[model samples]
Target chain A: MFCFIALLVFSVLGIFSATHRKFAKEAFDCVFRRITFRPCNTGFREKVRGIILVKLMKRSSFFAKVFNKYFELIAWIFFVLMIVSTFYVGRGAYNFYLYGNCNGVNEEGFCLFDPTGENNKISPVAPTCGLDTPTVDDLSLANTDLDKFFFIDNNSEDTVVFIGCYVCDFTRKAFPDIEKLLEKKKPNFYFGHLPVKHGSDFISSYDYCAREDTSGDYWKFVELMFTSDIENINDQNYLQEVVDKAGYDKSKIDECLADPETLASIEQNIFNIGNTNIYGTPLVFVNNKAIVGPKPYRVYKGFLK
Target chain B: MNIKKLRKDFYFLQKKNYIYFDNACNSLRPDCVVEKINEYYKEYPVCAGRSNYALAEKLTTDLLGVRKNIAKFISAKEDEIIFTKNTTESINLLANSLDLKEGDIVLTTDKEHNSNLIPWIKLKSKGVIHKTINSNPDNTFNIERLSKVLCPEVKLLALGMSSNLDGVSIPAKEIIDLAHKNGSLVLLDAAQSAISEKIDVKYLDVDFLAFSGHKILGPSGTGVLFGKKDLLEKLGSFLVGGSTVHSSSYDDFELADIPERFEAGLQNFSGILGLGEAIKYLEKIGLKNIQKQKLVLNEYLSNELLKIDKLHIIGPEEASRRSGIVSFYIDDIDSHQLSIMLDRSAGIMTRSGQHCVHSWFKSREVASSLRVSMSFYNTLDEVKKFVDELNNIIKILR
Candidate 1:
C-alpha cells in the first residue's frame, strides 16, 4: 500500500528531479511484485519509513514514535485519501470539459481550469426589475410559453431556447457561437430578448417589430444589435441605421415601434423569459438542459441530437 | 595523538561534517593521499616498466619506490609485494596461482570475509578440498579448532586476520606457526586489520598477506599481496598480459619477475601512488597510536550501546577484543532501518547487513546487524553523537 502511494508521488516528482526517479523506479518494482502476490521487498518501505521517522524525530520524538508505531495504518489512510482525491480530480476534469464549469452546468464556482469563472459569468438582471435572483436549482425552462416568442421552426425534434439581451456583455460574447449553432443544427430555435442591461429595452421592442416583418431579416438585426458598440446600441439613429443595414423596412419598423401593442408584446416576452427563473442574460436551454452563460461552442453543440 | 589536528588532514571530515563510522568499508583519504594520486596524473601518467621513454622510466622508478615503501610497511622485501585491484583480487590471485592439486585441502575460519572465503571456496572446483574451522561461541578465533584441522593434507590455511563483521582479530602469529608445523602455508586476509594493527610479516612469519588500499585511507582499486620472494617466484602467474611477461611469441611467453609477473596488464598508477602516500601518512601517525585512539572510541561506544535494552553486540563483550568495531542488532528492529535512521537524523554513516560474511550470519540465524567501525581521526564527540542518534532511532523504531 505504501509502495502504491510512493509510486504515484515519486512518479510525479520524478518528472522534474533525477533523485526521485530512482525511488520511483524502486517503488514501481515493489508495486509490481506486490500485485503478483509475491512479498514486497521491505527495503524500499523501510528506507522511506526511516527517512520520514528521522525527519519527524528531529522536531518531536513523541510524534516520531507515534508515526513509527502506526506507519502501516497511516500508509493505508494516505492510500485511501489518494484514491478519493484522484476520483474527484478526474470527475472535475470531465465536468470542466462537458459543462464549461467544474461544478456542473449553469453553476458558478472557482475552477482550476477557469480560475476567474469567466465561462459561467453573466450580466445579472437589474434589482430595479423587482425580481429575486434565482439559484441554479430554480433555473428551469418549464412553464415558459415559447409560442409567442420569435422562433425558427425547422421541424427538428431538438429545441433550443436562448434568452439574451443585446446590450449585455456575456450575451454579446455568446452571440457568434449561438449563431454558428443555429446555422449548423437548425433546431426549433427561439430567441427571447429580455433587455437585462440598462437602456437596452427599446432594442427588444425594435427586435419584436423587425421579426414581424416578412423580410426574414430578424436574425440579422439581432446579430447587428449584439455586435454593434454598446453605447451606439441605445441610440435611436444608430439603431435605425442597423435596422436598415439588416435589410428591414425603416418605415414599417418605425410604425411597429410606435404601436402600443409592440410594448405589450415585448413586456409579455420578458414575462415568459422570467418564467424560466432566469436571473441573467444568455440563459440557453438545449432541449431540457439549461446553460446560463457564454459556454464554449462544443458544450452547446454537445446537446444536439 | 591530536585527533583534532589529524581530522584536518581529511577534507571530507571538514566539509561533510558526517560522523563516518564505516571505516572498515572505506576510510576517508587525507589530502596528502589525494594530492599524490593527482600528482601521478599531472606529471607522469604513462605505462610503467614497459616503455623506454623518460616519462615511462620515471613512472617505473616511482612505482618501484611505492612497492618498496609498501613492502617495508609490512616488513617484506620489495619484490614480495604484488599489486592487484583490491583484497578480493589479491586473494583470488593467490587462490588461482597456488600449486594445490587434487585432494589438497584449504582450511579457513568460520568468520572469514567473502573475499577470503569465496576465493578458497572457488578452488573446490579444481578438486581442492575447502573446509571451515569453527570459531569460539563469542566469535573469536579458536586455536584449538585450527590445530585439529591443520595437517600435511591441508595445503593452505586461508583466514581473515580480523573479521570485518565483528572486528575480532585472530592470533595470526600463533596460527601461522601452528600451520607451518603441520606443513600448511598460511594466507592472511588483512583488509580489516592492516589499517590500525601493526602487521610485521617478518615477526609474524606469515607466508602471505592481502589487504586493500581503500581501507587504509588510500585510493580504491589498489591492493597489495605480500608473499615470500621464493614462494612468489614458485607460484604461477594468475593474470598474464604486457607487464606479466618479459617477451612472448605466438604460442610461448617468458614470464616476468615475481611482482611484475603477478601484476598483469596496466596498473592503477595513481591509486598505487596514493596508496604509497597513505602508508607514509600512517607511518607518521604510527599504527600503535591509531589502534589506541580507535579502542578508546570503541570502548566508549560499546559501553553506551550496552546500556540499551535488547541491543546485543555481535562479537566479544570486551571492546578491546572487538578492535575499533561495534556491531549490534536490536531484538525486533531492522538493522538497515536503524542504520538509515541514524544517517538521516545525524549524518552518522554505518554499515548494516551481513558485512559480506554471509556464512557466519546464516550459521548464526541472524537476519542482519549494524556495524560502526571507527578510525583514528574520529573524535569522542562523534562517538557520543552516534550513540545518541542510535538511541533515538531505537527509541522510536522499537
Candidate 2:
C-alpha cells in the first residue's frame, strides 16, 4: 500500500529530479511485485519506512514509536487521500474540457483553468433595472416567449438567442465571434437588446423600431451598430445616417419609434428577455443552453450539433 | 599521540563533523596516502615491467621500492610479497595454488569471515575436505579444540587473525606452532588484525598471511599475500597472463619470479603506492599506540553500552579482549534501525548486521548486531556523543 503511494509521488517528482528517479524505479518494482501477488522482495517499503522513522526519531521517540507501530494504517489513509484527490482532479479536467470552465456552464466559481473567471465574466445589469441577481441554474430559456424577439429562422431546429447591450464592452467583444458562429452554423438565431449601460436604452428602442420596419435589412443594421464606433451609435444623427445607409426608411423608423405600441412591444420584449434571468449582456442561449460571457467561437459552436 | 593532530591528517575527518566507528570495514585514508595515489596518475602512469621508457623505468623502481617497504612492514622478504585486489583474492590465490590432494583437510575456526571461509568451502568440489574448529562459549578462540582437530590428514589451518564481527583476535603463534607440530601449514587472515596488531611473519614462522590495504588507512583494491620463500616457490601460479611468464613457446612456458609470477597482468600501481605510503604512516604512529588508543575508547564505549537494560554484547565481557569493537544488540530494537537513526540524528556511522561472518551468526541463531569499531583518531568526545545519541534512540524506540 505504501509502495502504491510512493509510486504516485515519486513518479511525479521524477520528472524534475534525478535523485527521485532511483526511488521511483524502486517503488515501481515494488508495486509491480505486489500487483502480481508476489511478496515485495525489493525491501523498498522497509527502506522508506526506516528513513521516515529515522527522521521522526530525531525529533521525538514517542512519535517515532507511534508512527512505526501504525505505519500500515497511516499508509492506507494516505493512499485513500491520494485516490480521492486524483478522482477530483480528473473530474475537474473533464469539466474544463467540456464547459470551458472547471466549475461547469455559466458558473462564476473560481476555476484553476480560468483562474480569473475570465470565461464567465459579464457586464453587470444596472440596479435600477429591478432584476434579481442571476444564478446559472435559474438562467433557463424554458419560460421565455421567443416569438416577441427578432429572430432569423433557418428552418432548422437549432436556435441561438443572443442578449447583449450595444454599448457594453464585453458585449462588443463577443459580437464578432458570435457573428462568425451564426454565419457558419446558420441556426435560427434571435437577437435581444438589453441596455445595461447609461444612455444605451434609446438605441435599443431605435433598434426595435428599425427591425419592425419590413422594408429594411435589420441584420445589416445590427452588424453596423456593433462594428461602428460607440460615439457614432450614441449620436442620434449618426444613428439615422446608419439607418438610411442600410437602405431603411428613416421616416418610417422614426414614426414607429414614437408609437405607444412600439414602447409596449419593447417592454414585452424586455419582460421576455428577463424570463431567461439574464443579469448581464453577452449571454447567449444556444439550443436552450445558456452560456454567460464572451466564450471563444469554438465554445459557442460546440452546442450547434 | 596527539589524537586531534592525527585526525587532521585524514581528509574526511576535516571536511565533516562525523563520528566514524566503522574502521573494521574500511579505515579513512589520510592526505599522504591520497597524494601518493594521485602521484601515480599524475607523474609516471604506465606499466612497470613491460615498458622500457624513462617514465616506465622510474615507475618500476618506485613500485619495487613500495614492495620492499611493505615487505619490511610485515617483516618478510621483498620477493615473498604478492599484490592482489584484496584479502579475498589473496586467500583465493592460496586456495587455488596450494598443492592439496583429495581427502586432505583444511581446518578453520568457527568465526572466520566469509573471505577466508568461502574459499575453503569452495574446495569441496575438488574433493578437498573442509572442517571447522568450534570457539569457546564467549566467542574466543579455543586452543584445546584446535589440538583435537589437528590430525595427520589436515594439510592446512586457515584462520582469521581477528574476527570482524566482535574484534576478537586468536592466539596466532600458539595455533601456528601446534599446527606445524602436527605437520600442517598455517594461513592467517589478518584483514582485521593487521590494523592494530603487529605482524612479524618471520618471527611467527607462519606459512602464509593475507590482509587488505583498505583496513589500514590505505587505498581500496590493494592487498598483500606474504608467504615463506620456499613455500611460495612450491605453490603454482593461479593466474597466468602477459607478465606472469618470462617467455613462452607454442607448447611450454617458463613462469616469472615469485611476486611477478603470482601478480598476473597489469597491477594497480596507484593502490600499491598508496598502500606503501599508508604503511609508512602507520610506522610513524606505531601499532602499539593505535592499540592503546582503541582499548581506551572501546572500554569506555562498552561500559556505557552495558549500562542500558536488555543490551547484550556479542563477544567477551572485557573490552580489551574485543580490541576496538563494541558489538551489541538490544532485545526488541533492530540493529539496522538503530544504526540508521544514529547516523541520521548524530552524524555517527556504524556497521550493522552479520559483518560478513554470516555463518557464525547463523550457527549462534542470532539475527544481527550493531558494531562500533574505533580507530586511533577517534576521540572520547565522539564516543560520548555516540552513547548519548544511542540512548536517545533506545528511549524513543522502547
Candidate 2 residue-wise lDDT, B1-398, digit = tens: 99999998988999988889999999999999999989999987788878889999998899899999989999998999999999999999999999998999999999889999999999999999999999999999999989987899999999999999899999999998999999999999999999889999988999999999999999999999999999999998899987899899999999998978999878999999999999999999999999999999999999998899999999898999999998998888778777877888788999888888889888988778899999999999999999998888777767
lDDT of 2 at A53: 84
In the range A218-265, model 1's lDDT, one tens digit per residue, is: 888888888889889879899899889989878899899999999898
Compose the digit string of candidate 1's lDDT tens values, residues B1-398: 88889989999889976888999999999999999989888988888877999999998898899999998899999989999899999999999899999999999999888889888888778899999999889989899888877778999999899889999999999999999999889999999999888889999999999999999999999999999888998998778887888889999999988888998888899999999999999999999999999999999999998999998999899999988999998888988898899888888999888889889888988888999999999999999998877776787886
lDDT, candidate 1, at B317: 95
- Interface RMSD in Å per candidate, to 1 decimal? 0.7, 2.3
| Regions more than 4 Å wrong, model 2 | A1-21, A24-50, A53-73, A100-130, A145-274, A280-287, A291-305, B99-104, B249-253
Model 2 chain B lDDT-worst window of ten? B389-398
After superposition, candidate 1 runs with Cα above 4 Å error: A1-21, A28-42, A108-116, A127-130, A145-156, A165-188, A191-194, A199-268, A296-298, B43-53, B99-104, B122-129, B151-153, B234-242, B247-255
Alpha carbon lDDT of residue B109, candidate 1? Answer: 91
Q: Candidate 2 residues A157-273, lDDT tens each?
A: 788999998888889988998899888888899998887787676797888988889878988888999999998899988999889978898889999888879878877888788
DockQ of each: 0.67, 0.38
Lowest lDDT 10-residue stretch of candidate 1 chain B: B389-398
